[model samples]
Target: MATLEIKEVAKRYGDRTVLHDINLTLASGEFLSLLGPSGCGKTTLLRIIAGFEHPDGGQVRVDGQDITALPANRRQMGMVFQAYSLFPNMTAEENVRFGLRVRKVDAAEQSRRVLELLELVGLANHAAKYPHQLSGGQQQRVALARALAIRPSLLLLDEPLSALDAKVRVQLREEIRRIQRETGITTVFVTHDQEEALSISDRVAVMYEGRMVQVGAPAAIYQEPTHPFVAQFIGISSRLPARVVDADQGVITVLDRALHTPRARGLQPDVALHLYLRPEGVQLQAVNGKDPQSAVLQGTVRESTFFGAVTRLRVELDGGQGVLADLSTHEALQLPIGIRVHVSWQPDAMRLLPAELPI
Candidate 1:
C-alpha cells in the first residue's frame, strides 16, 4: 500500500494539449477511477502516472518520493491494459511467473508466488492452460494474476474489462474489486464507462477536455454534481428549459410551477436555465380526468425501457420538451409508448445548471 500523488501534471502533443494542470492525491490502498468520454484525456493521465508518458510539467510521486523520472520497470507498479497481452505459448502459471523470473526471485519463491496469485484470481485450477485455451474472461484473469504476481506497490488498469462482453465485464469488475481490497494495493483505474467507475471506486474523478471537473464519492458525485458536464455525463437525466422568474426568492419556473432552488438565488430574471430531473425522481400517474388539475406536469410517453425492477420513460411534454420518469415495472406495464400521463417530481431531486454549455 502506498500514497500516490499527481501534481500539476500537464501534457501536450505538438499544438494540442492533452492534459491540463491536474492535481490529485490518493491515500494508501485507495482506489480511484478516472472517468470521461473517449477523447477526454483520462487515458493520457493514466499513462503519465504509469511512467509510459512524461508530463511536460509537474511530478508523479509515490510515498513522498518524486518518481517522475523513474523508468516504468523501476516504478514497481503492475499494469493491466485493455488487451490481455498474455504470452501465447505460456500457461497461466508460466505467465504469472514471468515477472518473478525476470526479477531473479528464488525459484521456490516464484512457484509459491505464482500459485498464490493464480489462486487469488481464482485461476489455480487452470494453471496449466495456455492463453489460446482460455476464454476472454479467463485470459484476463490470468493477466490480472500475472500483474499481481509482483506484489506491486501500485496497480494501474486501463479499461482492462472493455474487451470482454457485458455480463463478463460486470462479474470481472466485482472480482477485481474484491481482489483489490484483499491485496490493499493502491489502484488507479481509467475508464470511459460511468457505471464501472461508479460501482467499484473509492472515489471518482470526472475529467472533460483535459481538466478535472469534479472528484467525489460515487453518491455525492451522482447526487451533487458541481459541473454541468458532470451532471449530464454521469447518468440519465432530463433537462427541462426553465427561466429564473424571481432571483431574490431563488425561484425558477419549470413548466407551470415555480420551484425554489438555491442555484437560482443570484441569477437574473428570465435567464435561461436547464432543470436536471433524474428519472428516479419522477412519478407517473394515470390521467383519469380532463385538465388533471392535481398533476404537476403532463406528457406522452415517447420511449419506455424496462430495466428489471424499474422502467425508464422519455415523456414528451406540451412544448416539445421532455423529462424522464422511472416507474415500477408493474406500473410501467400500464403505460406504453404514446400513452398520456401525469408527471410529478420530488423537488429535492432536481438540479439546476446553466443553460449554456461548451461544445
Candidate 2:
C-alpha cells in the first residue's frame, strides 16, 4: 500500500555500532526480507523502520513523506513478533477487534471487520477459541489477522514463523505469502532462515556484522553472489585453492588444470586464489578418459551419503583437500569408498576470488 525508503540509516549503542549507512528501497506491495545471522542488525533495522527504535542518523520515508521522527503508534505500521502476543483472556474475534476498538471504531464496523478478518485467515470457525485452545499456527494466524485489522500502510514481521513446528512453519509461511498477496501490503520480513527468506521474499537483503553485503532476487543471490561473504553465507560451497595464471583473462590454475573464470578486480597473476564450487556444479566421472575442454581434478571417493533422490559424495583430492559432489542415487551407488574418480566442473560454474579476501 506504500513505498518505503531507508536512507543512510545508522545506529549505535555505547562503543559498538549496530547499523552502518544502510540504504534500501521497497516498491509498493513488494515483500522484502532482511536476512542475516544473529547480531547482524536486521532486527534493529526493522525496529527503526517501525519507529520502535530511533536511529542515530538518516531518514525513513513512506510515499515521500518523512516519518523518521514519528512515534511508533502514528507511523501506521503493523508489527507481528515471533511470539504470538495475544491476550490470553480474549477469544480470536475479540483479539482481532482490539485494534479497531482502540481506534474508537463503531461497534457494528468493528464486528464486521472482525468477522471479515477471521474469515480471511480461515479461522472464522474458531473465533470463539481462546489463546490456549489454538495451536501455534492458529495463534500466528490470529496475530496476523490482528495486524491487518488496522489496515496499516506497512507490515513488519520479525521472524513470525520461528516459534512454529517445521511442518506448521512451512504451512504458515505459505499462508502469510498468500495473505500478503491478497492484501498487497508492503511487508518487511526479518529472519535468519535462508530457506524461508528465499522461498517467500520478492527480494532478499543479506546482512553481515553491521552492513548489508548484498541484495537481490533469491535466484540471483543464490546463483551469482557478488561478495565472498555472500557466497559463503547464501549456501554451501567448497573452496579450492588455486593460483592466478592470468588476471586480465580471468585464468586460474587449480589441481594442475588451467581454467578461465570471470575477471576479479585487483587480482594479479601468480597470486593465490580461492575457487568456490557449489556441490551441484561438481560432477563425478570414472577415471577412464579426460575431456579436453573440461577442468578436472583426480580424487578418490572418501564417503557417500544417500539422500532420497540424490547422494552426496565427499571426494578427497590427491593433495588431501576435499570437495563435495552431488550425483543421482544410481550414479553415486556405482562409486563406493576408495573408488578413484575424476571431479570436474564448468569454468563458469565456479567463482574465483583472491585467497586473502576477508569474509
Candidate 3:
C-alpha cells in the first residue's frame, strides 16, 4: 500500500482554468471518490495522477517520492478507464495475464496470478471467454483483474461502473469494494452518482466547476454540508431565500417564519441568504382540521413522484415558492394532487449560503 499526496495542483487551457490549486492526501488503503458533474476536472485530476496528463503546476507524490515527472508506464499505477479497453483477440484469462507478461513475469507465474485474480473477481469460470462472448459486467471484471494483476501501489478507477445496467452496477460496486478491502490498495474512484459515492467510499470529495469543495464521510457530506453546491448535489433539496433576523442567536426569517439554525450563526443582521432543506427533512401534513398555529408554511401539492418506499411531493407555497418533502407511500397516498398542506422542519436540518453567487 502507498500514501498518495497531491499538492497545489493546478491546470489550465488557454485562458480558462480547469483545476485551481487542488490539494488532497490519501491514507494507505483508503478508498476515496472524486464526485462531481461533467467537466468538473475530476477525470482530469485522475489522469494527472496516473501520469496520463501533466500538471502545469504542483507535484504528485507516492510514498513520499516525487512521481510528477514519471511516465505512466513507470508509475506502477493501475488505471481502469470508463470504457473497458479489452483486446478483442484476448480471452479473459489472457487479458488478466497481459500486464504480468508485459512486466516480463515467467509464463507459469503469469498463469498462476491470472487464475487467482479471476477467482478474486468471481470470473474464474469465464476465464477462457472472449470479450465479445462475455456480458458488459463480465468484461469489466476482466478489466479490473488486469489492472490489479500488476499489483500496483495505487489504483485509479474512472467511472468504471457507469456503463453497466442498474442492477449490475450495484453488484459490481459491492464486488469492487470487497476487492479493495482484501487487496488493501490505496484507490481513487471518480463518479458523478451521489448514491454510488455515498454507498461505497470511505470519504467523498465533492467537486464543482473546477475546484474540490468538500471532503468528508458520506453521512457528513449528506447531513452537514458546508457548501451550497454540496447540499444541492448530494440529495434532493429546495433552496429558499432568507434574511438574518438575529445573528447572535442564529435566527433567520423565511417566508414570514423565523427559524433558528446553527448554520445561520455569525451572519450580520439583514444579511440575505439562501436556506437549503433536504426533502426528507421537510415535514408535510394535510391542512384539514389542522391547527393553524402548527402550520409554518402553507402550500398545495403540485406534484407527487413515487419512489418505492418513499414518495416525494412538490408543494407550491402561497407566494408561488416551491419546496419538496419526502413522505412514506401511505402518507403520500393521502395527499393527492390539489390537496392543501402545511410544511415545517426542524432547525438543525438546514444549511445557509450567501444570497449572492456568480450567475
Name the top lDDT candidate. 3
TM-score of each: 0.94, 0.95, 0.96
TM-score of structure candidate 1: 0.94
| Candidate 3 lDDT for residue 230 | 88
Residue 95 error for model 3, in Å?
0.9
Model 3, runs deviating above 4 Å: 288-294
Better of 2 and 3 by lDDT: 3
State the C-alpha lDDT per candidate. 0.91, 0.91, 0.91
Query: Candidate 2: global Cα-lDDT?
Result: 0.91
Tell me the TM-score of model 2. 0.95
For candidate 3, the lDDT comes to 0.91
Clashes of 2: 0
